[model samples]
Target: MKKLLAECLGTFTLVFAGTGAIVINAATHGSITHVGIALVFGLVVLAMIHTFGDVSGAHLNPAVTLAFAAARRLPWREAPGYVVAQVAGAFAASLLLHFLFPQDTTLGATLPLGSDAQSFVLELVLSAILMLTILSVSTGAKEKGITAAITIGGVIALEALFAGPISGASMNPARSLAPAFISGHLSHLWLYLTAPILGALLAVPLCLCVRDSTCCCASPTSGKS
Candidate 1:
């Protein structure tokens, strides 16, 4: 229960601060700016990891939780609980955002700036990179501590900065889902849900390349969990 609460609150805070930046920037007529919004996402992730990483690995993103499970660092049985917590937290944040800024159309929902295929590809690449970084920095079964936080946060920041104009750089399904769901802007929701999971899963094989094969493909009894 403590772990679940930690995961929920961490995810809630992540969506609140990160998506809040987007809503605020729009409300204030770009006062936060694109770079500032990206910074908010990164900083919030850093803060959350520092806050809850020890308890639940700070997996605020469902794709991330799934990726860890795929890499055998987490148990499959635990994945659903984490994903549910993350989605719940994200919806909580989205509902609050809707109440706070009702007039905003998208409510920070990510939409493709160009073709849907382009956004799909970008999201896949972005999530793959993000998951790869998470796996690389994580120590043992934990994705916590200073190094993990900074490196993962940095990767998110960089991805958002470079790709926000194109695909909104949403590497997390929950991040994209909450706002799209509440705002009725779910036209491209499928891309987000499928791309990120595929991208995160793709990182598993990549991890095997640089690290010991056991590090990424461990079984339940291989000491990963």
Candidate 2:
């Protein structure tokens, strides 16, 4: 229960602060800028990992949770709960944003700025890189402590910086889902949902190849740190 609550709260904070930057930037005519928005997402992720990481492993992204389970670091049984908590929190944030910015069209939903194929490939590669970093830094399923927070946050920021223009850098299904659902921008939603999962799953085998067998195939650990 505590873990679920932590995931919910952590995900809520992430979506609220990150997407709020986009909404506010649009409302204010780009005061925040693309770089600023990317930084906001990175910084908020750093803060959340520090805040609730010990409680829920800060699996605020469903892709990360599923990847950990696939890597045998987290039990499969726990993945669904974490995903649900993340999605619920994301929806809560998007719903609030919708209410606050009633005239806003997308509410920070991720959309493909180019061809769907282009964004899809970018999202897949970006998610793979992000998951690789997480798998490298994490302990079992948990992404806690200073190292995990900084490295994971930095990777997210970097990816968003480069790929935000094309793919919106949505490496998380829950993060992409909420705003798309609320704002009714579902045309390219399938790419965002499927690519990240496939990418994260791809990282598992890559981790096994590069890392020691024990590192990627360790016995499942408790969800908490």
- Each candidate's lDDT (Cα)? 0.89, 0.92
Clashing pairs in 1: none
Q: Write the per-residue lDDT of candidate 1 for residues 73-164, one digit (tens) a residue.
A: 88888888889999999999999999999999998999999999999999999999999899988855577458889999999999999999
* Model 1, runs deviating above 4 Å: 219-225
Candidate 2 — which residues are off by over 4 angstroms?
223-225
> What TM-score, over all chains together, does every model reach?
0.96, 0.98
Q: Residue 158 of candidate 1: its Cα lDDT?
A: 97
lDDT of 2 by residue, 1-225 (tens): 899999999999999999999999999999999999999999999999999888888979999999999999888898899899999999999999999999999999999988999999999999999999999988887864688998998999999999999899999999999999999999999999999999999999998899888887778977363
Which candidate has the highest TM-score of all? 2
